[model samples]
Target: MVEAMAKAKLWTSPGGKRPDATLYAAILSDMRKGKGARFKKPAPGRFMGA
Candidate 1:
């Protein structure tokens, strides 16, 4: 099961800050193994002084 899912691609937020290629690859690897998707923190200074 894990192997099958791993074959599938992982998705990332396009609007998200530029992510490290290696880190993204790792996350995708994990997700493919049935691990939950990783959520990125909100972009810095997005709501500053709100």
Candidate 2:
């Protein structure tokens, strides 16, 4: 995730392409594969700050 975030800084969206969409697709894939997206749900009234 850190690597992707770093790479994002160097990415440029040409022709109105959405780079974030691609990143999200990869995240969903990882979630489906039981990888990085196994985070527990945040408690009520407790925000998960970025």
Candidate 3:
């Protein structure tokens, strides 16, 4: 996934910018992946009231 993203030109930053395209892309990708996994269904009886 990282390789694919790196190759897609999805990451971009202005010239002389503090953050390069690769860094921005990585952070964005990580944020997206993190959000995707932030919510997980609990197993039966795992919660206070199953």
Candidate 4:
């Protein structure tokens, strides 16, 4: 997913991590997952936000 997802300066800013795969491995790396996840994907191709 790292090589797949586009890397941008915003991800690097504020001392962010490298590669997008890492985030996915950690239940979205502290973003979204399932069952008590921080986010909810109600609609297709849309994030409800944090």
Candidate 5:
């Protein structure tokens, strides 16, 4: 799914092809592939619910 999204040339939107969506898809794709290290999962019990 991430690969498909990343390979897409454009994201169809009501406003037409959106580069923002493409950028987001690319980010998500990278994260899915474990390449994004800037963002890390919060430690357990750090959240309000926990």
Candidate 6:
């Protein structure tokens, strides 16, 4: 998950190895956006496009 996002250049700032966790936090935040979310977790430690 993080590998794909990192390769896609998801985060512009806070660059480097920080994506290991910051990415998940950012992704989880979107999940709380209700119907406008950017991602969804069908299972633990797993993420897919919403």
Clashes of each: 0, 0, 0, 1, 0, 0
Taking every candidate in turn, the Cα RMSD to the unseen true structure, in Å, is: 13.7, 6.8, 11.7, 6.7, 11.4, 2.3
lDDT of 3: 0.44
In candidate 5, the residue pairs with backbone N, CA or C atoms under 3 Å apart (3 or more residues apart, or in different chains) clash, namely: none
Q: Which ten residues in a row have the lowest lDDT in candidate 2?
A: 41-50
Candidate 5, residues 1-50, lDDT tens digits: the string is 33453469433433437656654554445445554333333554221111
> Which runs of model 5 end up more than 4 angstroms from their true locations?
1-16, 35-50
Regions more than 4 Å wrong, model 3: 1-19, 35-50
Q: Compared to the true structure, candidate 6 yields what TM-score?
A: 0.72
Residues 1-50 of candidate 3 have per-residue lDDT tens digits of: 33453489754444444555555444545545644533233554221111
TM-score ranking from best candidate downward: 6, 2, 5, 1, 4, 3
When 3 and 4 are scored with lDDT, the better candidate is 4
Worst 10 residues of 6 by lDDT: 11-20
How should the candidates be ordered by lDDT, best one leading? 6, 2, 4, 3, 5, 1
The predicted structure with the larger TM-score, 4 or 6, is 6
After the best TM-score superposition of candidate 4, give how far the Cα of residue 37 lies from its true spot, in angstroms: 0.7
Which pairs of residues have clashing backbones in candidate 3?
A: none
lDDT of 4 by residue, 9-49 (tens): 32322335743444444435445444666655566644444
- TM-score for each candidate, following the candidate numbering: 0.31, 0.40, 0.29, 0.29, 0.36, 0.72
Model 6 C-alpha lDDT per residue in residues 20-43, reported as the tens digit of each score: 678778889999999999889999
* Candidate 2 TM-score over all chains jointly: 0.40
Q: Residue 47 CA error for candidate 6 (Å)?
A: 0.4
True-structure lDDT of candidate 2: 0.46
Q: Among these predicted structures, which one has the highest lDDT?
A: 6
Residue pairs of candidate 1 with colliding backbone atoms: none
Per-residue lDDT for 35 in model 4?
Answer: 60
Candidate 4: segments with Cα more than 4 A from true spot:
1-33
Candidate No. with top TM-score:
6
Q: Give Cα-based local distance difference scores for all models.
A: 0.41, 0.46, 0.44, 0.45, 0.43, 0.80
